[model samples]
Target: MLDFFSSNPIIALAVILAVGLAIGQIRFLGISLGAAAVLFVALGLATANPAIQIPPFVYQLGLAMFVYVIGLSAGPVFFKEFASRGWKLTLFIIALLISLVALAWVIIKALGLDSMIGAGMFAGSLSSTPGMAAIVQIVNGQDPSMVGEPVIGYSLAYPGAVLGTILVAAIGAQILKVDHLKDASEEGLITAPLVWKGVQLSPEITGKVGDLPRLSGQSIIATRIVDDPHSHRLADPQLPITPGMQLLINGTEEAVDKAIAALGEERETKIEDTELIYTRLTVSNPEVAGRTVGDLKTVEHGFMIARIRQGDTEVVPDRNTVINLSDRIRVVVAPGRVAEVRKFLGDSEKSLADVNLLPFAIGLSLGLLLGAIPIPLPGGTTMSLGFGGGPIVVGLILGALKRTGPITWQLPFHANRTISTLGLALFLAGVGTSAGAGFRGALTDPSSLIYMGTGFGITLISALVCAVFCMAVLKLKWDESMGVAAGVTTNPAIISYLNGQTGTDLPNRGYATVYPTAMVGKIIAAQLLFLLL
Candidate 1:
C-alpha cells in the first residue's frame, strides 16, 4: 500500500481532490485548498518518503491550465465593468497591491532575509503559489530546482491565509446583516397592489366615436394609460376616434351621465389600463440566437427590448449585436400590444440548468494551451508561457479579437465553477508535492525558518491592517473586505468562498480585479527580496 501511494502521484492528487470535494460539500470544518496542501505535506511526512518527488513540468502544466481557466472566466466581464464603473474599483485594487508590496519590502529590509526568501515569504503570506512560481521563474529562470526553496516557503503560510479569510468573511456577514428583501418590503419599492385597480369609462363617451363631443380641447385623465401623474390633451377637437380612448364630462359618475345626455353617445365597455401591465417573456426562437442588439431591431416588436441580462452581466442592447436564446428581456409597452410583442418573439422561458458546458471546456483547454507558450519579459528574464497573469492578458486579447472562440459564447456559471475547481485542485496539488519534498531541506538551517516566519509575520500584519482599513475606513462590505485579503493571497478559492457567503455569482469578478496586481507585486517582491538579501 505504501509503495502504491509512493508510486502514483496522480492517484495521490485525485484522493486529495476527492477529500476536498467531500469536505466542501459536507461543510466539515471549512477545509480550504491551502489547508489541503498542508494536509498532504503532513501525510507525506508521516509516511517518511524521503524521495518524494513531483515532476517540475507538471507544475508548469498545472499553472498554465489554472491561469487559462481563470482568464477565460474573467475576460468578458472585466472590460464591461471597466467601461461602466470607471476607475474606482480598479484604483482600489491597484492601491491594495502596492500596499502589499511595500509592506513586504519593508519587512524584508528589517529582517535582513534573503530577497528570494522574502519573496517566498510574501507569496506564502498571501497564499499565492502562482505568484511565487512566477517570481522564481523570473529570478532563477525556468529551472524549478533552483527556485524550489521560495516555493516551499510560500506553501508553509498558505493554510493560515485561507482560514483567516474565512473567519473574516463569516464575521463580516454577521456584522453587516445586509437583507435586501427586508429593505425592499419596508420601502414599498414595488407596485403590485396598484396593479389590481379597476378602470371605468366615462358615460360622456358613448360607443360611437363621432357622437362623442370632441375631446380634442379637453385635458383627458390618462393616468392609467401611461402611469404619469400629468395627463395629455388632444390638440384638435376635430380629430377622429382611436380604438381605446376614454372621455369624461366631470369628475363624478352623475356628471358623466349628464355629459352623455348632452353628447348623445353611449358608453363603451371599459378596458384594462396600459400602465398597469407588466410583461415577462423569454427568448426561444432561433432567429435571435447569436445576434447582437443591432440585429434584433429587424424582428417585429423587438424594439420593445429594454434590458438584456445574460448570466450575471446585464447590458442595454446595441444595434450591431446579436441576442442569444435564454437571455431575459424586460420592456415597457401598452397592455394590449404586449401580446403582439410576445407572439412575435416566441416563448422566453429559460432554465438556468440548461447552460451548455462544451464551449466552456473548449475555451478553457485552448486558453491553457495558449498560456503554456513561454514568452520573454523585459531584461534577461523569460517567464513560462502557461497561465498566471500572462494568460489572462492573452485571453482578453483573444476574446476581444474573437480569435479564441465565438464572440456570442457567454460563459455559464456551472462550467466556470467546474473549471475553476479542477484548475485550483491541480495547482494546489503541484505546489503541495513540490513543497513537501523541499520543506525538509529548507528547514535544516534554523535561521532560514526564522527568516521565513518573520516574512510571513509581516504579510499577516500587512494583510490584517489593510483589511481593517478597508472595513473601518472604506466601509466595504464583509465580502469585499475579505476579497482584499484574498487578493493578497491571489487564490481563487478564497475569493470563491467569500462570494459564496455573499450569495453572489461574481466570484470571477472579484478574482480578476485583484489578480493581475497581486501577481505582479508578489513576483517583484519575491525576486527583489531574494536579490537584495
Candidate 2:
C-alpha cells in the first residue's frame, strides 16, 4: 500500500484534501480549522509513511499564487492606510520583531543551542519562510554541514506556530467582543445603494455636462440624454447640453437630487422609452477587461455606464473607473444598439466562469523575476525578497494600477478567492508533509521538545503583545490589528484565517500596509541572528 501510494503522489494528495475538507467541516466547541485542516491531515499521514513525499514545486507555486491574489485584493486600500498610519504601524511591527529576536537570543544562549537553531526558531515561530531562507543561506556559507539544522528547528516549531497564531487571534477578538460585520460596514467597505432620477434641463443651466455644480464628493453618472421626444442618446460630459433637453442620472439619492437641481427640475417621464432602454449585464469580455470607462467610448457607442457591482460591493463608476471581468454593470443604451453593446461586453455565462490566465501568468512571472534579483546588504552580503515577498509586492502594485497598457492586473472577485484558497491549501499541505519526518524525529528527543516549546511560547507571546499594542495604543480595529499581526508574521495562513473570520478585506488592508516592510525586516533579523550571534 505504501509503495502504491508513493508511486501515485497525486492521488494521495487528492485524498488528503478530500478528507481534510470533510474533517474541517466538523465543529468542535464551535471552532473549526476550515481549509487549514489540510495541513494537519497531511502532517499525520506523512509522519506514518515518509515515502509519501510531495514535490517542493507544489508548495512554492502555491505560496506565490496565494500571496499574489492577496496583494491584488488588498492593494486598493493598502497605500491609503499606509499614507495615514504607515509609519506608526511600520515602527510598531519592527520593534515587536526586534524584541522577539532578542528574547530568542537569550533563551537560545541559556540552552547552549547552536546559532542556526535560534535563527530557525525565530523564523518558525513567526511562520516566516523568507526569514528561514535568509538564515539558511547564511548557515550554508559558514558551515554547509549545518544546513539541516535550521530545517530541523523550523519543522519542530512549525505546527505550533500555525495553530497558536490562530488561537491568539481568535481569543483576542473574542475578548474584545468585536462586531466584525458592523465594523466593516462603518468603514465604507460596503457600497451604498444607487438611485436614478429623470430631469429636464433648466433654462438657467448652460455649458458642458462636466461643468455642472454638484454636491461635494458626489458620484453621479449622467446616463442618457433626450434631444427630442423621439431622439434620445447616452449623455457625455463633453457634450453641450441645451435647455429643455431631458437627462437620466444615476447616483446616490443625495447625488441624484443635487444633479437634478443643478440641471433642471424632475419630471414624471420615462427616460427609457421602447427604443431607448437600460440593461444591467455582466462584463464577461476579456478584450474590455483592462479598459477604463472613458476608454470604452461609451457615448460614442451610444451607451452610458451607470453603476457597477462586484461581489458584495457596489460602485458608481466614472470615466476613470476600470472595468474588470465579471462585473455587473448597469448601462443605458440608445435605440437598436443593444446587440452591439452585448457583443462588446461579451455577456456570456461561460466567459464569466473562465479565468483569464494570460495576465495572471505574466504578473506571476514578473514577480518571480523580481524575487530572484539579488539585493545587497550593509555587510557585503546579499538577500532577495524570495518567493514569499516577491509576488505580494508585485500583486499590490499591479492591483493598485488595475492595469498597465492592455494587461489587466486584477482578477475577478470569485476567481481571486478560489485561486487564493486553493493555493493556500496546497502550500500548507506540502509544508506539513515535507516537515513531518523531521518533526517526528525531533519529537523523541527531550532537548528538541524544549526547543519546540520555546518556539511556541515565543509565537504566542509575540502575537498577544502585538494585538494589545495595535488595539490599545495604535487604536486600530480588531480586524486591522490582526491583519498587521499576520503581516508582520509573514504567514499567508494567518491572514487567510482572519479573512474567513471577519468576512471583510479590512484585515487584508492592514496586512498589505505592513507586509513588504515587515517581511524584509524579519529576513534581516533572521540573518542577523545567525551572523551576529
Candidate 3:
C-alpha cells in the first residue's frame, strides 16, 4: 500500500479525497466536520508513510481552481452588496478580522514562538486553508527549510478552529435566546413565491392603480383583469379598477393574502381558455442579458414578464431587477407571440449545458496573470495576491461584469458549483499530503500541544468578541450575527450547522455578505503576519 501511494501521486490524492469525504458525512453530536475531513485523513496517510510524496503543482492547481470558482459564484452579489447596506456589515467584519490578527500577534510575542508557526496558527485557528497556503508561500519565498514549521502549526490548530467556531455559533444561538422560526419568518427568509390569488375589486378600492396601499417588503404583480363575463385584459398597474371586477395577482403567499384583504373578498377567476398564455421562458438572449425585467422589449414582443427564477430561487421581479443569463422567466404572453418570445430568449436546454469556452478560458487566464503580478510594500519587501487571492479577486470582478461585449462571464449555476466543489476537494487533499510529514513530526513534540491550545483560545476569543460586536454594536439579528461569525472563520461546517439550526436562509445571507471580504482579508493578513514578524 505504501509503495503504491509513493509511486503514484494521483492515486494517493484520490484516496485522501474519497476517505475524507466519507468521514465528513458522519455526524458527531449533530455536527459533521464536512470537507475538512480530507485534510485530517491526508495528514494521517502522510504520517503513516513519509514516502507518500505529491508534487507542489497539485496543491497550487487545486487552490487556484477552488478560490477562482468561488469568486465567480460570489462575484455578482459581492459587488452589488457594496452599493447597498452590505458595505457596513463588510466594514465591521474587516474590523473584527484586524482585531483577531492583532490578538494573534500579541500571543505570538508573549509565547516566544517562531513567526512562521504563529502565522500558521492564526490561519489554522480560523480554519482558513487558503490563508495557510498564503503563509506557506511567503515562508518558502524567504527560506524553503522554514516552510515545514508553518504547515506543522497549521495542522496542529486546524481541528480546534473548526470545533471552536461551531461551538461559538451553537452557544451564541442559545445565549441570544433566538426563536428560530419566528425570526426567520419576520426576516422574510422563507422563499414563498408563485402564489396565484384571485380577488374582486371592491367599491372601497377607489382611485387609480397608484392609490392602492403599499405592501411594505412585498412585491405583488397583477397578471390579469376580468372586465366582464366574456372579456379580460392583461392587468397593468396603470389600469383603473372598477367595483365587482375580477383580478388575478402573483406574489408571495403572505403578500397575496395582504393584497386580498386590502382589495376585497376572494373570488374565482378562470383563465383556462384565455388567449393570454402563462409560460416559463429561459433567458438566453444576449441582448436581454443585464437588462432589467421592465427594460425588456416584452411589450413590443407581446409578452409581459410576471416572474423570474434565478437558479432555484424564485424572484418577484421589479422594474430594477436585472435579467441574468439562463433565468427562467415566468412570462405572460399572447398566443400569437409564443414563437417571438422563444426566439428572443434563446431558451435552449442544450445551450445551458454548453459552456462558452472562450470566456471561461479568458477569465481563468486573466486570473493567473493577476495572481502572478507582485505589489511593493512599505518595508522594502513585496507581496503578491498569490494564486489563492488573485484568482478570486479577478473572478469577482468578471462575475460582476456578467458580460462584456460578446463574452458572457456567467457559467451555468450547477456547473460552476461542481467545479468549485471539485477544486476544494483537490486543494484540501494536496495541502494535507504536503504537510503530512511535518504534521507527524509536530505530533510528537511536547510544545506542539501548547501551540494548539493557544491557537484554539485565539479562535474562541475572536469569534466570541466578533459575535458580540455584531449583535450589540451593529444591532444585527442573532442568526445573522452567528452566520457572520461562521463566515469570519471560513468554515463550511459552521455554515451548515447554522443552516440546519435556523431552518431558514437568513444565516446563508449573512454568510454570503461577509465571505468575500473576509476571505480576501484573511489571506492577505496571514502573509502580512508572517512577513512582519
Candidate 4:
C-alpha cells in the first residue's frame, strides 16, 4: 500500500482531497492538494523527471482572470475609499509589513540559510506569489526547483491564512455584538415606503389648500389632484406626519381610533392616469454598434429614447447619439409595451454575447507580452515579464487608457461571475494540491514553522491594530473597521464572512477597498525582506 501510494503520489493526493472536500472539510482539501502538488514537483526534481512542469500559459490565464475580476470588483470606488478612509488602515498594514520584512532579515542572518531559501521564506511569510516570482527573477540561474519552492510555500499558507482571518473576524463581530437591524437603518438600507394608508396636509400648506373636503380624512391622496404627483411630492406619504395641517389622516392604530372617535368625515378621491411611460434597457447587441438613438426608432417597436448612460457619464441622448454595446438606454413607450421593445431589440438572452472579445484578447495579450518583459529593478537586477506586479499593473493601466478600440466594453456580469468562480476554484485547487505535499516539510522544519507561526501572529496583530485605529481614531463603524482590518490583511474571505454575519453586503465593498493596498503591501514586504536580507 505504501509502495503504491508512493508510486502514484499525485493520484493518492487527489483521492485525499476528494475525500476531504466530500466531507465538507474544504480547508483540508486546500492543505492536501497544495501538499500533493508541491510533493509531486519536489519528487520529480529529486528524480530528474522532465514531465513535472506547471504550464506557464495555464497559470497566466488563471492569474489574469483573477486579477481582472479583482480589479473590476474594486472599480472606481476603491480609489475613492482609499483617499477617504484608507490612511489609518494603510499605515497599520504598512507598519506590520515592514516589521515582517525586518523579522525575516534577522532570522535569515541568524540561520545562515541559502539566499534563495531565505527569499522563498520571506515570500511565504507574506503569501505574495508576485513577490516570489520577482525574487526568482532577480536570482537568475538558481535551480528551478528551488525557485518554485517560495510560490509553493505561499500557496500552502494562503488557505490557512484565509480561514484564520475569517475565524478572527467572526469572533470579533460576536464580541462586538453588531446588530443587523440597527446597522442597516444607520446605513440607509431601510427606505421609507412610497405610499401609506392615509394622507395628511401639513400646516405649511397656506395657499388655498386644494379640495380639502375630498382628502380630509383618507390614507391615500387622490392621484388626480396633481397632474404629475411624482414631480410634486417632496417626500413619500408613508413618512411620519408633520405639524401644520388643513387636512390630516392617521395611520397608526391609536391615531386611527382617535380620528374615528373625533368623527372625521371620509372622502374618496378619484384615481388618475399618470403612470410612467418610460423604462430603461441596456443595449445588448454587437450589431447595434455605431447605430444612433434615432436608428432605434426605425424598428417596429413604438418607443421614444429618453436618455443614455455611457460609462460614468449620463447624456440626454439625441438622434446622433450613437448606440454602443453596454449603453443603458431609457425608452418611453405605452404601458405594457416593454415586451414589444424587448422583442424588437432581439432575444434578452443575448446580452453578454456583445462583449467585444477582441479588446479582452488585446488586453490579455498586452498583459502577457508586457509581463514577459524582463525589466531591470533598482539594483541592476532584471525581473521576468510574468504574472508579477509589472505586467498586471501595466496591463490595467494600458487597458484603462485605451479608448478608441471600443466605445463601450460591457463586462458580462454573469459571465464574469462564472469565470471568476471557476478561476478562484481552480486556483484554490492548485494551491491545495501543492500545500498538501509541502505540509509535512513545513511542519518538520522548526525554523520554518517559527516563520509560519510568526507570519500568522503578525497578520492577526496587524488586523487588530488596524481595526483599533479605524474605530478609535478614525471613528469608522465597527463593520467598516473590521472590513478595513480584513482588507489590510489582504483577506476578502474575512470581509465576506463578516458581511454574512451582519446580513448586509456593505462589508464586501469594504473588502474590495482594502484588497489592492494589501496586495501591494504584501508584495513590497516580501521583496524588501529578500533584497535587504
Candidate 5:
C-alpha cells in the first residue's frame, strides 16, 4: 500500500482528500474541521511512506488559487469599509495581532523553541494557511529541508487555535449573560423583511412612474402598473400613470408601507397576465455580464428587470445595477419574449456552473506575474509577494473593478467558491504530505505539547482581545464581536457555530465586515513574526 501510494501521487491525493473530508464531516461536540481536515489526513498518509510526495507546483498553484479567490470576494466590501469605519477596525486588528506576536515571542523564548517552528506555531494558532505558506517561502528560500520543520509546529497548534477560539466565545458569552439575539431585536438592528405590495393611485395623482413618492433612503422599486382593468405592464420611467391605477412595488415592508401611504390607497392587485409575465434568470452569459440593468436595453427587448438576488442579499434593481455572473434577476417580459430573454441572459444552469476559462486563466496568469515581481526593501534587499500574497493582491483589485473593457475578472459566486475550496484543499493536502516525515518525528518531542498549549493560549488571548475591543471599545453587540473574533481567526467553523447559536445572519455581517482586512493583515503579521524571530 505504501509503495503504491509513493509511486502514484494522484491516487494518493484523491484518497487523502476523500478520507479527510469524510472525517471532517463527523460532528464532534457540534464542531468539525470542514476542509482543514485534509491536512491531517495527508500528513498521516505521508508518515506511513515518506516517499509519497506531491510535486511543488501542485501546492504552489493551490496556494495562489486559494488566496486569489479570497481576494476577489473581499475586494468590493473591503474598499467600501475602508472608506467608512475600516480605519479603526484595521488598526485594532493590527494591534491585536502584534500583541499576539509579542506573546508568542515570549513563549518561544521560555520554551527555547526553534524560530522556524515558533513562526509556524504562530501561524497555526491564528489559523492562517497563507501565513504558513509565506513563512515556508522565506525560510526555505534556499534550503528545502527546513520546509517540514515549521509544518510540525503548525500541525500541533492548528487544532488548539480552532477549538480555543470557539470555547472562549461560548464561555465568555455565557459568563457575561449577554443575550445576543434579544439585544439585536431590541436595538432594531434586525434585517428588514422584504415584501411585494400594491398601491391604488388616488384620483388626484397623475404622472410618470419615476414621479411616485417613496421612502427616503430606502429600496422601493416600481415593478409593474395596472392602467386598464384588463392589462398590466412593467413600470418604466417613460410609462405614464393615471388615476385609479394600481402600482405594484417590491421592497422592504416598512419602505413599501411609507410609499403606499404617499401614493394612494393600499390594494391587492394581480399583475401577471398573458401580455406581461416575469421570470427569474441566472446571469451566465459573458456578453451581458458586468453590464448594468439599463444597458440590457429592457425597452428594446420588451422587458424590465425589477429585482436581483446576489448571494443572501436581494435588492430592487435600478438602471445602474451592474449585473454580475450568477446573479438571479427577475425580469418581466412580453409573453412571447421569454425565450429571447433566456437566450440573451444565458439562463442555462450548465452555463452558470461552468467557468469561463478565458478570463479565469488570464486573471490567474496576471496574479502569478505580480507575485514574481521583485519588491524593493530598505538596505538594498528586495522582497516579493510570493505565491501567497501576489495572487490575493491582484484578486482584490480585479474583484473591485469587476470588469475591464470586455473581460470580467470576477467569476460567478459558485465558481469562485468551488475553485477556492479546491485550491485550499489541494494546498493543505500537499503541505501535509510534504511535511509529514518531520511531523512524525516531532510527535515524540516534549516541546510539541508546549507548542500546542502555547497556541491555545495565543488563540484565547486573541479572541479575548477581539471581543473586548469590539464590544467595550467599538461598542458593537456581543454577537457581532464574537463574529469579528471568528473572522480574525480566519476560521469558518467559529462563525458557523455563532450562527447556530444566534439564529441570525447578524454574526455573518460582522464576520464579512472584517474578514478581508483581517485575512490580509494576518498574512502580513505571520511574515513579520517570522522576520522578528
Candidate 6:
C-alpha cells in the first residue's frame, strides 16, 4: 500500500483528501478539524513513506486559489471595515505577528536552532502556507541549499500550531464565559443578513409603505400587499396601506419585528395566486449598472426590489447599495409589469451563469507579475510576493474594486468556493507529502519536539492575547474578537468554530475584514523573520 502510494503521487493525493475530509467530518465536542485535516492526513501518509511527494506546482496552484478566493469574498467588507477601523485592526494584526515571531525567535535562539528552521516554525505556527512559501522564495534566492530547513520546521510545527489555535479559541471563549448566541444577537451580528417576513397592517397603521421609518438602517421592501378581500397586488411603496391588510415584508428579522410592533401581527401567509408576481431578474442592462438601489424607480416602474442576490449572499439593498452587472435581483411586480421590470433588470439567468474568465485571467496574470517583482531590503537582500501573495493581492483589489466598466473582477459565489476549496486541498496535500520525509526524520532528531512545543506555545499565546486585547481594549464583542483572532492567523477552521458557536457570520465578517492585510503582512513578516535571523 505504501509503495503504491509512494510511486503514485496523484493517487496518494486523492486518498489523502478522501481520508482527510472524512476525518474532518468526525465532530468531537461540536468541533470539527475541517480542511486542516487534509494537511495532517497527507502528513501521515508521507511520514509512513518517504517517497510520496507531489510536484510543487500543485501546491502553488492550490495556495493561489485558496488565497485569491478568500480575498475576493472578503473584499467588500475588507474595504468597508478598513475605511472605518483598518488602521486599528491592522496594528492589532501586526502586533500579534510581531509577538509570535519574537517569542519564536527567543525560543529558537535559546535552543540554538537554525535560522531556516526558525522561519519554518514561524510560518507553521501561524498556519500560514503563504508565509512558508514566501520564506522559501526568499531562501531560494539567497541560499538554495537551505530550502528544506523551513519545510521541515514548518511540517513539524504545523499540526501543533493548528490544534493549539483551536484550543486557544475554545479555551479563551470558555474562560470568558461567553454566551456567544446572546452576545452575537446584542452585537447585531446575526441581524446583518437581510431576511424575509410576513407582516400584517393593522387598523392603527397609516400612510404609504414608503412613509414608514427606515427602522435602524434596515431596508424594508413590501413585496406583496394582501387587501381585506385577500386580493394580492405588488406593493407600490407609495401605495397607501389600508387597515386589515397583509404585507410580505423583506428585511432583517429585527427590522421586521420592529415593523410588526408598529404596524400589525406577524402572519405566515403564502401568496401564490396573487396578482403580484415575484421573480428574480439578472441585471444585464447596461443603463442599470452603477446605479444605486434607491435610484431604481421601482415604484414608478410598477415593481419593488425585494432582494438583490449578489453571488452567494442576498442583500436587502438600501439607497446606497450599488447595482452591478449580472446581479440577480428579486423584484415584486404585477404580471402585466413583468416585461417592464425584466427590461429594467435585463432578466437573463443565462447572463448570470455566463462568466467572463478574462478578468480572472488578467487579474491573476497581474498578480503573478507583481509577485515576481523583487524588492531590495536594507542588507542587499530581496523579497517578492511569490505565487501565494500575488494572486491574493490582485483578487482582493479586484474584489474591492468590484468592477471596471464591463469587466467585473468577480466569480460567482459557488465557483469561488469550489475553486478555493480545490486549491487549498491540493496545496495541503502537496505540502504534507513533501514534508512527510523530513517530518519523520525530525521526530528522531529530538530537537523537533522542542520546535513543535515552541510553535504550539506561540500559537496559543498569539490567539489568546489577541482575543483578550480585542475584547478588553478594542471593546469588540466576543464573536468579533474571536473572528479577528482567527483571521489574524488565517485559519478558516477557527472562524468556522467561532461562527458555529455564535450562530452568525460575525466571525466570518471579522475574518474577512482583516484577512487581506493579515495575508500580505504575514508574507512580508515571514521573509523578514528569516532575513533578520
- Report lDDT (CA) for all predictions: 0.52, 0.76, 0.79, 0.50, 0.81, 0.77
Q: Between the candidate structures 1 and 6, which one is better when assessed by lDDT?
A: 6
Off by over 4 Å in 3: 199-218, 227-246, 260-267, 281-289, 334-343
Candidate 4 vs candidate 6: the TM-score winner is 6
For residue 455, model 1's alpha carbon misses the true position, in angstroms, by 5.4
| Best-fitting candidate, scored by lDDT | 5
Model 2: lDDT of residue 169 = 82
lDDT of 4 by residue, 189-301 (tens): 43223221223344443233223322334222221122233322212222333343323222333433344333333333222343435467776655454466555543246
Compared with the true structure, what per-residue lDDT tens digits does model 3 show for residues 383-435?
A: 88888888889888888777787777777676677777777777777767767
363-408 in candidate 5: lDDT tens per residue?
7888889877877755565556778887888888888888899888
Candidate 4 lDDT for residue 330: 61
Please, what are the lDDT tens digits per residue for candidate 2 over residues 11-89?
8788778888788777664456566678678777777786777676787788788778877877766666677898788
Off by over 4 Å in 1: 24-47, 50-52, 84-86, 112-117, 136-143, 166-294, 297-386, 398-411, 441-479, 496-512, 515-533
> In model 5, what are the clashing residue pairs, if there are any?
none
- Cα error, residue 260 of model 6, in Å, equals 7.6
Kindly give the number of clashing pairs for every candidate: 23, 0, 0, 24, 0, 1
Candidate 5 structure, TM-score to reference: 0.93
- Candidate 2 scores a C-alpha RMSD against the true structure in Å of 4.2
> Which pairs clash in model 6?
62-423
Question: Between 3 and 4, whose lDDT is larger?
Answer: 3
In candidate 6, how many clashes are counted? Answer: 1
Better of 3 and 5 by TM-score: 5
Candidate 2 runs further than 4 Å off: 24-34, 79-95, 111-121, 129-186, 199-207, 211-216, 226-232, 241-246, 253-274, 352-358, 378-381, 444-475, 486-508, 515-533
| TM-scores for every candidate against the unseen true structure | 0.62, 0.80, 0.90, 0.64, 0.93, 0.84
Better of 2 and 5 by lDDT: 5
